[model samples]
Target: MHEQLKQQLEHAQAGDRGALARLISVLESGGSDAAILERCLRARHGGGYTVGITGAPGAGKSTLVSALLGEVLAEPGRVALLAVDPSSPLSRGALLGDRVRMQPHAGSPDVFIRSMASRGHLGGLAMATRSARRLLEACGWPLTLIETVGVGQVELDVASATDTVVVVLNPGWGDEVQANKAGLMEVADIFVINKADKAGLDATRRDLEGALASLPPERRPQVLETIATEGKGAAALWQAIRDHRAAITASGELEQRRLAQVRSELKGMMDALLANQVQRLFEGQDAHARVLAVSEGSLDIATASDQMLDLLYDQAAGRV
Candidate 1:
């Protein structure tokens, strides 16, 4: 690594927010430097607890996150928030509306807030969010909050990336059928009924309860109500978070989940590398010739694919 990068990492570990921001920017940009930085911090990662908040748009997720910060900061240690937002079609940059809503804590030395663009990535999380979380962990932030972009039925990448997944919804969110169809049910560690002051609170709670009835009592996520706009129930929500963490940690589930996450990340990296290699192989002269032959009916696609695989194996074996 470069001298400046090394100095920045050291400064970040010592709690220099500016240096930490620069390091995260480098990771988001991605290259050899980012790879080297990740390698350097590999042993130091995984210190903090990460919480993910996700829900449909207009669910007041940003407001709930801001409200929760008050409860989180009431204690001693610093916390970091990574808010993911939709990308602008023109610039592909974060809209940053979440940052605006969370500006109350922006000036605090102990609060670090970052807004990331999803950039058309599936599952409502930015591609760089995982790396940023690792960087925050290495820097000694005891708690990290990840607020995902507006998600509907299927966006669930946040669950794989965090320790706890909080799924937010409004009082009149939907019927039991819709709740059951949403993939959120599969990953939510806690269900937050934000805007609880609105109508249909009881009905919504019942629907959620019914949808979750299949899970064993010990496995069911608690459904909490909150009026985030008024900061109502924030303290209780934080307490519930703490209780859930304690339970998971004591049962050894926390460590298991983290190990599973590392395994999944490694698999994703391998898939990406393999995809790149496959693309390169397809663009090679021999593969192009095979493609032409197959298209001209002089060779079958199966044989052509076999030949390409043979060529790839030869290249890998240093016999090309």
Candidate 2:
């Protein structure tokens, strides 16, 4: 297994598209090979810039991303695009509708596009995307564009993972201002008023500008208007993102932010591992019997919980 992973990693590094696809597939599924691959990639990782584009559905996020892809690829370098879509509640599979919208760059060797279902992650990103971004960096892609599930402004994990966060909004976003205050406002490094050809554009832009002006000058984000379908403002938006990245790099804030995210990821992993163990224990016959016993009043809830805790500790210790 180790030797096979090594070969795949070598091929991916050497720019073999098939090998890189296999590597990304392994990482996306959170398979057995994933941790090994991530560790290997971590050693070779020269960090690249990740830009996260997030906002409400119908905000033209896909169109903006398509435009930005053209802008980014104008300079020669590999780019990886992850279009995260909402998972089907029953099937838990991605609809992958974003891929159809991004078909313009389908054949670009320097551009690799992948669709990921959020898989019930309410944060609007597949849980594996951070690892995938690192894998992209290791595979020699110098830039990654993460387009969120477009569930709305509440999606913040993509912002946490990326170096720059671009929040896209439509012309009628004024009424949603209060709801967005907690989500997009805090994460946006740049605000994009997409679909500038639409009528309420000036009003939407002012709403954004007014809210931004009330903040301290240093915390203000750049606001730009874009007609994504016509390819109107992508270049300026890209430049704003680059400028923000450069500013954060010189300010040492980028390292500070990434360190915090790493700690968050580690703690999240530990919590999830423990939760999965507890869940497995609950699925066992003995645990089921205990649950039925509690329901029948033969066992109290508190006592049953104590017994479960004991079992958990025993099981964890045995594994250790």
Candidate 3:
């Protein structure tokens, strides 16, 4: 399996889309094979820039992403989009709304669009998103876009994971409380008012501006308006994104952001790995006996847990 994945990685780096898709699938269903692939590709990763788009449901994020694809693809390089969707409770599969909405780019070789199931992961991203983005980077994509599964608030993880985060809102957004309540104001690198042709556009802009007034002038996110369905203002939005990237890169903030993201992702992966180990320990026969002993009052919870930890330590040390 390791050799097979290495071959797949080589082909993917050589522009084989099918191979790349297969590699992404392997990472999505993570295990030893995924770890092996990560080890193989670690040195080659970190070439691409990731931008995240997030907002509340019905904010027209998908439409805006579709419009932005045109602007991104007008350049010479390949671009990848990872559109996160809510997982189906029964099937644990992507809902596919984002993919369906992005059907226009389905046949474009220069554009790679994938819908990922959130798979019960929190903060609007699946565990595989990090791996998939790294894989795309290793395969030489210059730009990657992640459209998060925008639940109401608490989508700030995307902001941490991506280089730039664009938060979308509609015209009546001004009627709501401060954007910070939704946690959008804290994470947004750029604020986009989509569906700007609707009523209350001016009020919403004023509200957004007023809220941003407290922020340092240089740190305030640029506010752009767009009617995504008509493909209006996408160019301006793209240019704003480019400008943000340029500013961050010039100030050396881009490298700092990437380093912090790497540290955060590494910590997350460690926590996940430890959790899996603990889960396996709980599922073991020894754990079953320990549970029975505790239920029968023959053993205390603390002692049983300590015994399990000892067993785990022995296994880790190759003594079990």
Candidate 4:
């Protein structure tokens, strides 16, 4: 680790807000700068609870998160929000429009709000989401809220990364079918039927209940109702989240989930790094020659794959 990098990381670990921001920028730009990440990981008390709020578009996820932010601000601790927005396809840029909806608490020192674009990433999360979470964790924020890009099925992946997954649903928008789907149902720790002030709230609740009834009691997630825009039922939602956490803890499932998440993240990072390295190595190379050989029956796809793997392994091992 360079002295300067170490200092920046140390400052972040020491709760220097500015240093923490800079560390996040470095990670967002794809710079490994492993020393900083290592320090941040080590400094992590892992005390924070990351709550993921996700659902279909127009389900009032943003409003729910904004209201929840307000509720969390009233408490006696730091809180951070990571709002993930869908990226523009042509420009491959994320507009982060949700931040505009959260302008009321923008200047609060105890609250940190960040708008992250998905950058056309497949997982419905920002490219630097993991690192961003680490940065927030390093900054002494005891709670982190991740508002995922609500793109239907893919949003389920967002749940695996959080301590608790809250799937916010609207009253009449395919509520039953969404809940019955394997992906969303499996990932939901708690279900929030937001916009409960509207009609069909009971129907939505029944739909969710019926779907959950088929699952084993131990696998069922608690369901809550919220009129997020008016801040109604927010306390009950919060209490439900806490109770869910307590249940997971008592069942010894929280540690298992954490370990699984860590392993998944590590594997994803390694896979991306390896793929990038392989692409760089083979760029503008004689791939045509290999293809031609394979076409002519002189080479096999398995052999080609093995060759590529060998090259990648060698490069990773510093033997290239």
Candidate 5:
């Protein structure tokens, strides 16, 4: 893996489009190529800032992300975007049209856009998103945008992954009452009232203002109005994001957040590894036969669970 990926990483860092795409594909493939990724990161110290764009569905998130990408691309640095869409159950691949909405810079060499499948991952993000973001950053994209699958209040793993989280809402989103209810209020560093050209815009703004009044000054997010389709408020939104970036960087919260992300990611990987071992046991013929017998009343769930645990322990002991 190291030898195969070395040239690609070098070319990717040098702004080769095909090489960059290939590197991103490798990361998205979720292969066990840790050494390759490690080498890539070693080539670049911290590169880009990531902005996580999330909110309820129908909030014009894709439109808004496209507009925001316009803002970022106007600058001189390279940009990469990941638009995560829900996966088809049969194919386990993205059922995507999100990328279609962002055709404004479709032909730009400075911009790279990729769509990823949520693959049943909760909290609106693809399971491989963090790795992909790292790859983009390593490749010298100064700004990476992640557009999530748009899950609602109950889930928000995106917050743990990015430097900033922007929550976009449309007018008439329960008039600030919904703001307090959804988990969006907590994670948002910048709040965008998209589709502001619609009716009830004033009402929504007031409600959001009222909701934000509860938080202490520094922690409260900046709320801006945007009609993303016409690109009316994207520049202001970008400035607000820049301000938030400055605040976090000046306050040392950026490093703190990255450290927290690293910890969470490491723990998640360990848990996934352990679960995979247990799952492999369940997939085996012997375990499957035993479980079938349990279902037939020849054994009990408690016995089956105990046997699984014993196998897990044996595997752990073997690793030791």
Candidate 6:
């Protein structure tokens, strides 16, 4: 199985599009490929920046990302896009219609666009996204843009994964309130008031300024306005992104955030694994009987919990 998986990964790394799709499928299914994905992650050398674009629906995040891609590709490096769509609960499939908006770049040799379904994940991110990003980076794609499903609050976790986070919002959309509620005002390295041609642009800018005013001078984010469809102000937005990157790098915050994200992800993985193992250990066992006894008042709840803990400890110590 490992050999077969290795061959698939090798094909993917060699730029076989079908192999790449298969590799993503394998990882998303969550078993043997999980180990393979971990190995691939460990083998990755540093690549281009990963920028996460997030905002509420109708904020023009896709248009903004497409424009930004143009700016990024002007520098002569490969760019990959991971557009995560909301999953349909009824069908358990992606509403991949958003990828249609980016279809023009599908044929660009320097650009690779993939639409990933959120797979019922609450964080507006695909469960397999990190692995997919690693795969793209390993395949020589220097830059990755992760465009998350624009469900406001859920975007925070997705933003934490990227090097620079661009929170895109449009004018008169109650964007300021949403930003504050989502805690986006805090996490955004670069805030973009997209669709600047719309009404209330100045008011939106002022609201953003007011929000920034509360933060310390050193921690305030730079804000830019863009009419993404016409490519207006894209240069300024790109420059702001670069400036944010430079600032974080100079302050050593970039490496610190990376290390912290790695640690958080590792801890989450370990906790999930432990929980799964514990669940399996109790399945079809006397644990259910103990629970029933405790519920029926024949055994105390505390005593039952203690016994379960003891059982877990014994199993960990190889006593069971």
Candidate 1 lDDT: 0.80
For model 6, residues 1-320, the per-residue Cα lDDT tens digits are 77887787788777787777777666555665566665765523666578888888778888888788788777777788888655653563434456666776778877888777544322224446766776777776777888876745446666767889888888875744464544787678788899999999999899778878988888887888899999888888878888888888899998888888677666666675677667876794768988899889999989988988788888889998
Overall lDDT per candidate, in order of appearance: 0.80, 0.78, 0.81, 0.73, 0.74, 0.74
lDDT of 3 by residue, 28-139 (tens): 6666887888787663244689899987777899889999998988877888998866556456443466777898887999999877754433222445787788889999
Which runs of model 5 end up more than 4 angstroms from their true locations? Answer: 31-44, 89-96, 118-125, 153-155, 174-180, 285-307, 316-320
TM-score against native, each model: 0.90, 0.87, 0.88, 0.87, 0.83, 0.89
Question: Tens digits of per-residue lDDT for model 1 on 1-320?
Answer: 67778899999999899999988777766666776777766632446999989887778988999999999888888999987655554564534567788989899888999876533332223446777888898889889998876664323675556899888888888553264445787788999999999999999999889989999999999999999999999999999999999999999999898998888766765665566667889888998898899999999999988888888778878998
Q: Compute the lDDT of residue 37 as modeled in candidate 2.
A: 76
lDDT for each residue of candidate 2 in 197-250, tens digit (9 for 90 to 100) = 999988888877988887788779999999999999999998998899889989
Rank by TM-score, descending? 1, 6, 3, 4, 2, 5
Collision count for each candidate, in order: 0, 0, 0, 0, 0, 0
Per lDDT, the best of the predicted structures is 3
RMSD of each: 2.9, 3.2, 3.1, 3.1, 3.9, 2.8
lDDT of 5 by residue, 121-205 (tens): 3222344676677778777788888887565432267544788888888889853437444577767888888999899999988
Off by over 4 Å in 2: 89-97, 118-125, 152-154, 174-178, 296-300
Single out the weakest 10-residue window by summed lDDT for candidate 5. Answer: 118-127
Higher-ranked by TM-score: 1 or 4: 1
Report the Cα lDDT for residue 278, model 4. 64
Residue 248, candidate 3: alpha-carbon lDDT:
97
State, as a TM-score between 0 and 1, how close model 5 is to the true structure: 0.83
Question: Which wins on lDDT, candidate 1 or candidate 6?
Answer: 1
